[model samples]
Target: MFTKILIANRGEIACRVIKTARRMGVKTVAVYSDADAGAMHVAMADEAYHIGGAAAAESYLCYDKIIEVCKQSGAQAVHPGYGFLSENAAFCRALAENDITFIGPPVGAIEAMGSKSEAKKIMEKADVPLVPGYHGDEQSIEFMKNEADKMGYPVILKAAAGGGGKGMRIVWKAEEIEDAYEAAKREAIKGFGDDHMLVEKYLTKPRHVEIQVFADQHDNVVYLFERDCSVQRRHQKVFEEAPAPLMQNDLRARMGKAACNAARAIGYEGAGTVEFLLDEDGSFYFMEMNTRLQVEHPVTEMITGEDLVEWQLRVAAGQTLPQKQDDLSISGHAIEVRVYAEDPDNDFLPATGTLTHLRPPQESAHVRVDTGVREGDEVSIHYDPMISKLIVWADTREGALRHLRKALNEYQVVGLTTNIEFLATLAAHPAFVNFDVDTGFIAKHENDLFPKREHITDDALALACLDVFITRDEEAQAQADWSGDPFSPWHSTSGFRMNDDNHHELYFVEGDDIITVTCHYRDEGYVMELPGGDVLVRGERDDNGDLAADLGGRRMKATVVRHGDNLEILVHGRAHALKLFDPLAAAEGQDEVSGSLTSPMPGKVVSVLVEKDQEVKEGDSLMILEAMKMEHTIFAPMDGVVADIFFNAGDQLEEGVELLKLQGE
Candidate 1:
């Protein structure tokens, strides 16, 4: 075994490899960018080095810097840990020339499979099943459109060197093909430096299932079953599971054998994954082979009781295969959910901010958490927003599903918006529960799944109101007591009365409308029984001025205060500033206003598509903002002139920043 190894990556995967290396008594070195100086993976390594700037091109992608760190640290081998230089053939050759082992497949295999077009040709020769598509070297605009016509509408244009859904587009019509092809090419060039693309017939209902293959130096290859990565958004996997729920014994055997053949055909060594797009008719086509460990490898590990990273180390150290195909068996069902810093309601756009609160559930015998961040860490726009991967295992698929849902529900994160609610809804969906969905599931059911919630219960509304009241009451009591006047009229027992004779009127605003509510005290607290006999209680206060009560069986932290006859409350991190009406004073007047346009989140303005005095229609793109590595276009709300342009391109704006103004006639 090697005495030491250097990991040429960062984040969860880096930490993952270090853990296995540690178990095998191998010291590990970690490399980090400026953004990850205090990251979890850095703290987990035996030795660490700072590479370059926060951007990937300057830091993780710098092969020379990584190689130098390896040599200086005396690392016997270098583990690419999947993303940065994992599949770079040049990096592999450099390590070999320097007498440092590259713990991955051979350089030739990586080169053959690194490009999608080349991989398709290689797989064709290997007799691997392939989808019908165009995989040639033609890049002309007319040629691509011609190929799409032959392949029929709904063809997928994928970047030859794409991963992580960066350079991919699905065109459903001829008119959209030209624009989509150009956009995909542009993004491909920017993201991978390779503008090569391949057009394929889009699968109507595709299930993304991949086989985990392992091989040693002696040409021994074995398949560790499959993972169903059908739950996806924007062509990216959101949820993954091992031992596909509805798979048959015969299908599993055939796919496993095919996976083994695919790996052996390339003389593959170390850990690799053979991805397949399974059709509704049980036929599977080779998608592409990932030349390194997959992001969702933990699900396979959980089911097979194997440490894949440890296998990579052993294979690279001149070891033979430890087990044959039959010896490998999945003992249980395992599922993994990728928790990202994103807003699912807004087309799953990535988000960036300081993670004010991050509390991952405790890992037990059946649950595993692979994370690369801490509570106070900043999820910047410079890197991937994946916060962590939560994995759960059980003897049965249903058991695993139940456990996973419980874990997700218990997970709590604040400060930044996430996809927790969306994930929960997905887990509870009937089609998902029955394993009857595929890649097209989200697109087909997006309306039902992403609908805006209406009909909020009156109980919840009353609770919100009581929350405001308690906060104001506490504030009023504090102010009166601070004056050091025992006879302050604000502290009179009559002030706490709850009957209609002494009822208090509270005014609060929701959106563009203001609502008035009346309340009174009852029993040990205040009770506002709705017309349907639903009772809401504002319980007695504790020493900390918090209401000691439960709302819908969930304990709540709240403060209620009263200013004169008005009540205000703080609940669930929001302060409800309210207006109170005194019996002695006249009612307050209301003001009418027109609608305003404000940014939904903090981001940098990337473009101004409209100028002042321009007449626009509703939904016209007014400006573009780049935040969390994705571009969002703000649109005109109504048919009007652009009254104002708040910020120009390259300006960083906070959430709710007004980007443009519209005037009403």
Candidate 2:
């Protein structure tokens, strides 16, 4: 076994590799960019090195810097955890040139699977099932359009050299093919430096199931069953599970053999995944192969009782196959959800800010959290905005899903928006519970997933009010301590009355409306007067921030997390956001700013499609901005003529910066 190996990546995957390496008694080295100076992975490594600037291009993608670190640290091997240089064939060759082992599939395997066009050719020769589409070398827009026309409507364009939902587009009509082609090409070049693309027939309601295959230097390959990655948004997997639900044993064996065939056909080594698009008719077509550890490998690990990273290390070290195909068996169901600091309602746009509060579900045999951040850490816009991967395992799929929902309920983060509630809703969806999964699950069930929340019940309102009272009393006690006057009435907010019961009003804003709840202290508790009815409530906050209380003699528990002026109260698996409403501020109204279009998030202007004084209809594209590695086109809000354009192509912009002005006709 190697004494040491360096992880040439950052964030969760990097930290994940280090933990397994540590368990195997191998010292690990970690590399970090300026943005990740205090990142969790760096602090966990036995040795760390500064790579470059905050951006990935200046740091993680710099092949020479990573190679230099390997030599400086005297590491025997380097693990390029998915993304970054993981699939870079040239980088693998460079490590071989320097006598440092690259703990992944050989350069031959990576190069074979690097280009979707070329990989399809290899699969065709191996007799692997492929979708009916064009996978060729022609790079012309007209050629792609012609091919798409022949393949019929609803063709999906994918970058030949990229994955992870980048450089991909689905066109439902011939007229939409050209714009999608150009956009996909631009994003492909930005992501993989390769504009080469392939067109595939988009299947309706197809489930994305992939087999985890492993091989070694001895040419021994074995399939580790499969993971269903059908739950997706923006063509990216949101939820992944192993031993895919509703899969038959015969189908599993066939897919497993097909995945193994693809691996062996390339003379593959190390960990790799062969993805397939399972159609409604039980026919499966080949999707591209990922020649590195997948982001959702934990699900596979949980079901098979295997450490894939450790297996990768062993395979790279010239060890024999750990076990044959027969020895490995799926024992239980596993599920993983990618918790991102992004808005699910707003096209999943990535959000950047400090994590004021990061409290995830407690990890046990049934639950796990894979992350590389801590409380107060900043979620930067320079890289993937993933918060963590929440994984759960159980004896059955239903039980695993139940655990998933429970874990999501306990998970909490503040200071920025997240997809936690969105995930919880997805977990409990009827379609999902009944195994109605597909690549278009989110789009298919939009209304149920993003439902408009109803107003809080009397109990929730009472809890919110109870929390307010608890906070005020704590503040009063602290003030009394500072003043050295325990009996000071001025510091108290009790609404004390000698003759009558103390009465108080608490105002809170949910969404855009203000709510007023009146309360009267009586009988050692409080009676809250709501629009619906009166309710008696008594609650106290526990050390763990849970509200243990009674609402009209009904006992319940909930968590109210406060950050700045916002309060996120989770009640009965539903999260509600409430802000303290100040009536005085509302009375002094301020004029709203208008007449200009502003940037939604910090990004660089990719293009300006409109000119000054140019007439535009509502929903016309005024400009496009690239941020968090995705392009967002700013559209006209109304029929107008462009009066002024503020930013130009390639110019950096902060959030809320006015991009262009439009004077209505």
Candidate 3:
């Protein structure tokens, strides 16, 4: 076994690899970019080296720099933890030339499965089930259009070198093919530096099931069951589970054999995944193969009680297979949900800010949190916005899902938006609970997940109001010697005044609406003038700093987390973000800023489609901004003429920066 190895990636995956390497009595080196100077992985490594700038192009993608670091650190091998240089065949050969072992598949295997079209052809030759589509090398608009026409409507365009949902588009009609092709090409070029694409038949209500296949240098291969990644959004897997919910033993065996065959056909070594699109009728077709560890590999690990990273290390060290196919068996059910720093209310847009509070679930024997971020860390817009992966395991699928809901509820983060609430909602939905999931699960049940709300609940609003009142009192008494008792009733309540009543009014902003609430102190309770009607509420803080409230004879418990003027209160199983409103500021900033297109997140302007005074209709594409490795087109909200263009193409922009102004006709 190698004495030391260097991880050629960052974030959770690199951290994950380091843990296993340490367990195997191997020292690990971590390479980081400027943006990750204070990253968790760098701190965890026995030795660390700086590569380059914050951008991946200047850092992780620079294989020469990584190779030089490996030589200086005396790392015997390089483990390309998924993404970055993980699947780069050239990098693998470069390491071989330098006498450093590459802890992944050989160059031949990578080249064979490097391109989607080439992989499809190889799979067909190997007698693996293949999908009906055009996987040709002719990369022209005319050729692609004709191929889509022959494939009929509802075809999917995928980048020849795409993975992780980038450079993918689905065309539902003939007229949409041209635009879809162009957009997919642009994204492909930007993401992978390859504009070549292939058209595939769009599967309806298909479940994304993938087999975890492993191989060693000794020509030994085995399949470790499967994971169902059908729960997706924007073609990205958000949730995954092991041993697909409705899979039968026969289907499992067939898929396992097919996956193994696909791996053996390419002479694959190390850890890889064979993805397939399983139809409702139990028929499956091969998708592209990922040549490294998958993001959701924890599910498979939980089911088999195996450490895949350890396996990768063992394979790279010329060790024989750890376990034969007959020795490995599924032990239980496991599920994983990706926690991202995004706003679910705002279409899951990537968010950037300081992590003021990050409290992951209390992990136990059955639950685990794989992450490389901590509280007070900055979630930069320079890379993927994934915060962590929450994995849970149980004896049964239903039990694991039930634990998933509880885990999400226990998870909490402040200072920026997240998808914790959104995940909890989906986990409890009827369709998901009943095992009726697919790639279109989110779209098919959008209404039930994000229901329109008329008003905030009375309890929630009351909690917010109380939070504001307590915060103000604490600030006022910070310097005073008001008995160090934190939960003193005297400090929280209005002083006992004979023949005098105290009334307090406060305003809070939930979203765009400002709620005005009046609190009148009574003998023991308080009368609140809410928007719905008058209600009596009583609340007090305990020594543990949790609030117990009684609103109109109903009891509820809540905890308020205050960050400056912003408050995040947890009631029941959901969390709400509210800001304390100031009447003076509201009056000064009452004018609505309309008729302008602003960048949703910090990004570079890819293209400006209009000039000053250019007329545009509603829904017209105005500009394209690339951020978080995704392109977002700013569109005209109404029929208007562009009055001003603030930024030109290739200019970096901060979030909420107005890109262009429009004057309505």
TM-score of each: 0.84, 0.97, 0.95
Q: By lDDT, is 2 or 3 better?
A: 2
State the lDDT of candidate 3 residue by residue for 359-461, as single tens digits.
7889997899999999999888888889999999999988898889989988878778788888999999988999989899999999998877546677888
- In candidate 2, residue 67 scores what lDDT? 91
Cα RMSD to native, each candidate? Answer: 5.2, 1.8, 2.6
Query: After aligning candidate 2 to the native by TM-score, how far in Å is the CA of 589 from where it should be?
Result: 4.0
How many steric overlaps are in each model, in order? 20, 0, 0
What are the per-residue Cα lDDT tens digits for candidate 1 across 1-665? 89999999888899889889999999999999999999999999999999999878899999889889988999999999877799999999999999999999999999888899999888888888999999999889899999999989899999999887877889999999886887678667767789899999998888999999999988788998999999898888999999888899899888888888888878899999999999989999999999999999999999989889989999999998767887888899999999998888878887778776566767997889998888889988777788999999999999998888878866766557788767878887888888888898888878767877443244445665565556666667787788898567766433354444555555554444455555555544555544345354655568855566664345665555444444444344323444443334555776433546777767788778888878888888888776543446688778888888888988987776667788854
* C-alpha positional error of residue 309 in candidate 3 after TM-score superposition, expressed in Å: 0.6
Score each candidate by Cα lDDT: 0.81, 0.91, 0.89
How far in Å is the alpha carbon of 317 misplaced in model 3? 0.6
Better of 1 and 2 by TM-score: 2
Q: Is candidate 1 or candidate 3 better by TM-score?
A: 3
TM-score of 2: 0.97
Pick out the ten consecutive residues of candidate 1 with the lowest summed lDDT: 573-582
Clash number for model 2? 0
lDDT of 2 by residue, 1-665 (tens): 99999999999999999999999999999999999999999999999999999999999999899999999999999999999899999999999999999999999999999999899999988888999988888879899889989989899999999798889999999999998999998888888889899998999889999999999999799999999999998889999999899999999999989999999889999999999999999999899899999999999999999999999999999998889988999998999999999888888888889998788899999999999899999998898999899999999999999899999988888778799989999999999999988899898899999997688766677888888888888988998999998887788776888887799888999877889998997756788998789988888888887899988879999888787667877787666789877787767766555678888887799999988989999999889899866788899999989999999999998777889989988
For candidate 3, which ten residues in a row score worst on lDDT?
488-497
